[model samples]
Target: MTPLIQRILLATDGSAYAARAEGYALFLASTWGAGLDVLSVLEFPPGMNPAYPINDVYLGQLRKEADRHLGRLADRASQIGLSVRKQVEIGIPSEKIIAVAREHGDDLVVVGTHGRTGLEHVLLGSTAERVIRGAPCPVLAVRGIKAEAVESAAASVPLAVRRMLVPIDFSDCSLDALEYAVQVAKQLDAAVTILYIMEPVAYGLDFTLSHPSELEAKRARLGDRLRDLTAAVTGCGLQADEVLRGGLPADSILDYAHSQAVDLIVMGTHGRRGISHLVNGSVTEAVLRRADCPVLTVRSPKFAPDHRRVIRKPEPAASSG
Candidate 1:
């Protein structure tokens, strides 16, 4: 199978959240043998004029601090024997992150969220939300855990994203996300769970699905599709499963992810050519902000496959005995 990530860009500040993101960046780089680019953006003061002479000293000090954070990331990557490049920039945080991604052709961009749910941060216009919305490559928004948990999770050597959850609505973009998730699973040796939530009917007609025959028919069809997807994942020789639930899409996704101990949540950023709007009312962003683990949002495949790499064939003959 072809690897999905070759170059990763990590955006950080000196916060605990960024530190967790750095751990993920290093883990992915080591797993994929990818190069890492660590970036820190020192935002210009809002009302201060750059022409003021005293501001130069202030800006210089901030630059040094940003570089300090970037340096830590570089040292961590080096300890893993991964190639890394570091940079410090002065600009808007999200804009600088997107610019670095475009300039460096990063396959993935990793950023961090600052709260328990991370939604409040996004609603208040946090850099993480903007980066997730505007980044040119797939963005992984990792929410901050408690300090002790953060230290334990980040300090685990040879970190692994052991189980991944992908919530799909069957749109083309969503299916693409599944493909991307499968590629990631192949690389990380992770288990994949494909979840489909059959939302309750609209207009407050909650009991409409209570009709036995009608609900049964729809469930049958959705089951078939979900099982087909599950088969595809298992065919890749990776551990895989399918889940069917009924609730609001975002709620169901978050609930299952938390209960299943998912290490990552992979999703599509948008929906079928403007019909539904990314899983009905920005569900991707909702889950992206609230998910416990890092959420990977993909609009399409992020990396070019290496053609020289040989494919792995299924080992069906072992079962013949």
Candidate 2:
């Protein structure tokens, strides 16, 4: 089978968390024998005048520092037998990272999130979140590890994909993520645990819920559906298991993953933006922020595949203005 991930882009800010992300990127690239790109962006403060002499000097210094950091990372990757290209760009960090991934048609993007929450996260928006929302392909968001843990495991720790957890909601986006997860499982000879969360509903205080028998019947039906979904995966010659839980989706998924010691989490995001996303919080984003393992987020495809087309069409010539 062809490799699912061919080109990987790893964006770094020279932080400890980013270094951990780089470790995962390097390991994956070596395992897949894929090309890797190390990208670093120099971000300037908003409202800063670039034309000012002092500002220009500061910008040049920042660029040089970024270059040096990327150069060293590239050298490290090479020393470990992974070939990588280094890139340095000046722009908004997340925007430039996404732009580079699109321009290169990279199959996967790896980034680190600091896992800030509440008012802090609101005031300082997450770059990893924006990149995942806008990336053209799949994104792997690595959560930051504590300093002491990094100190102990930084050198030899590798991301183990022996067990993978995938949360499914029967949405096209979730199914797409499942398919990708199955492919990765096949490659890694890993097992996949599919989870379906039935969110608890609270009726009005005056209303009473259904009978126990009726709830059991509903749970049985959902279990059947989950089994049906896993049939394809099992038929693909990989071990698969299904679990149905009742609770908050994100919390349930994370709890299951931690309890099972899952090495990876593959899930889908609807990619909602702005007010819509704020109002309807994203389960995927929540999981990404707190997942102990690396979370791979695949956005829903805009267009379905055309299976009827067997032959390729020639490109039209461009007209010169």
Candidate 3:
């Protein structure tokens, strides 16, 4: 069978977190015998003196430094018997990364996130987050790891996607994630666990007695759906299971990952932005920030115009005034 991922793009900034991402990219590229591209974006320095005559010279120096860094990363990949193409561009990191990934039609874009939260994350937005939101294909965001840990792990053996978790919300994106997870599981001989989280329903005091029966019915219905989904995965020759939890989606996902010692998380992102994103937030993003394992986020192709036209329902027109 043909490999699911043919090419991988790894974005780095010469940071420790980027190094960890590089490790995963190398492991996957070698495992799949896929082509690899290493990219580094050189952001123009902020607060530089625009009036200074030597500004251009400083920019040249920065470019040279970035090239050298990328070259060294390429050398490391070569030492591991993996050929890689190195690229350096000057622009906003996130925008440049997305543009390159789109231009090359990469199957997957891999990058590292610092996992910052609250004021820190707000003030210093994550490049990984932006890339995941806008990339044309799936993205794998690796959390930051210590240098010592990375070194030790690299010396020992290549990483494996042994146990994967997929959180589903019955959306097209979630289904796409599940499909990708199953494909990966098939390739790696891994087990997959599909998790569905339902919010607790609040009922009026008058309906208190009947709520228990209603809840039981809902659970039974969900169980049926879960069984169907698991059956489809098992048909693909994979070991699969399903979990139903009641709580906040992100919290439930994280708790399950920790309790199960999951190695990887494959989830879907709605790619919401601006006001809508602010209001609804994103469970995937929350899990990306807090989860201990790597998160592979698949943007639903159903959102594309071509796919949308197939599945979208017609809207009612307004009456003429």
Candidate 4:
């Protein structure tokens, strides 16, 4: 049987945000019974202080710091009875992160929004963003959790994946993500919420000019499709529901996720071979950047062995409402 996630690689730079991501990666590794590789890259020579300079001694110190971070993560993984390994690399953070993930055949790469080198501090030119753009597998970009929020709850209790959100546009890439999310929900006993934006321009007229009957008919067809898909998931013994809204897709997604307190947002992306969705202002990229919770981006199955992933397309985007 194809496991949902056989291997997980976590890229950390020992920042507080990275620590938060480590907790999540460790939790997921334990839950999925997957091997965890905790990787830390020493992006020295630039972020290093002028006093430290670029000498062998400073390089050694950087390696030691990276090891210190990996050691902490590996210890936690071991305590949880997880199979964990540690990796320390020397290079640019994003390049090394993608290279390590590719070398290890990691099914998922977890990263904090900001790295030790502050590559992810700015969303556009950040290390985490670059990794998301080029990683070989699914990328989980996690932002730092509020300390007050963690403290108010029983923070020691492991984080849960109770609610998952998947935004679909009836595209192949989106279906690939839905399949991945379904497997995860089944494994973790999480409920899923599928979001579909209702665009009225398909009728060749603006929303204001569309006839009420046209609008009603459009809703009926989309609702049927949504129900069919949601039922397909529930048929697998997993709970699922659908939401249909009319507005900008990304804004609607973020609003619903926040109001509903979704734990994870799973969206689809075309492979790295194409022009990046980032340049095209993709809804998936927008949600990834602004979602209140963690966002998991999955590409199509071209990169791996397929397990009968025959995704039924509702219709083509140009024609589908």
Off by over 4 Å in 4: 44-53, 117-121, 146-156, 199-208, 271-280, 300-306, 314-321
The stretch of ten residues in a row with the least summed lDDT in candidate 4 is 271-280
Clashes of each: 0, 0, 0, 1
The per-residue C-alpha lDDT of model 1 at residue 276 equals: 36
Put down candidate 4 lDDT per residue, 147-203, tens digits, no spaces.
445444435766899999998877778888888888888879999998898643543
lDDT of the candidates, in the order given: 0.79, 0.79, 0.78, 0.79
Model 2: per-residue Cα lDDT over 4-25, one tens digit each = 7788999988766566788889
User: Per-prediction TM-score, please?
Assistant: 0.85, 0.84, 0.83, 0.85
In model 1, which regions exceed 4 Å deviation?
A: 45-48, 115-124, 147-158, 203-211, 272-281, 303-321
Score candidate 4 by TM-score against the native.
0.85
Candidate 2, which segments miss by more than 4 Å at Cα?
Answer: 115-124, 204-208, 271-280, 300-321
Tell me, what's the RMSD of every candidate? 7.2, 7.5, 5.3, 4.8
What lDDT tens digits, residue by residue, belong to model 1 across residues 1-321? 355788999888766656677778887888889999988887875677765888888779988888887777777678879998988887788899999999998999988877334343453267887887788888888776666676786556755789999898887778878888888888888999999988765543564435678789989999988888888789868999999999878889999988989989999988632323443447887786677788998964564645321222224455564
lDDT of 2 at 154: 71
Quality of model 4 by C-alpha lDDT: 0.79
Candidate 3: clashing pairs of residues? none
lDDT of 3 by residue, 1-321 (tens): 446787899998776556668888988888778789999887755576633768767767877887888888788888878878888887778899999998887889998885222222331258888998899888999887765576776677668889999988776668778877777787788999999987656555776544678889989999988888898888767899999999877788999999999989999887323343465467888888787888999983322222212112225578998
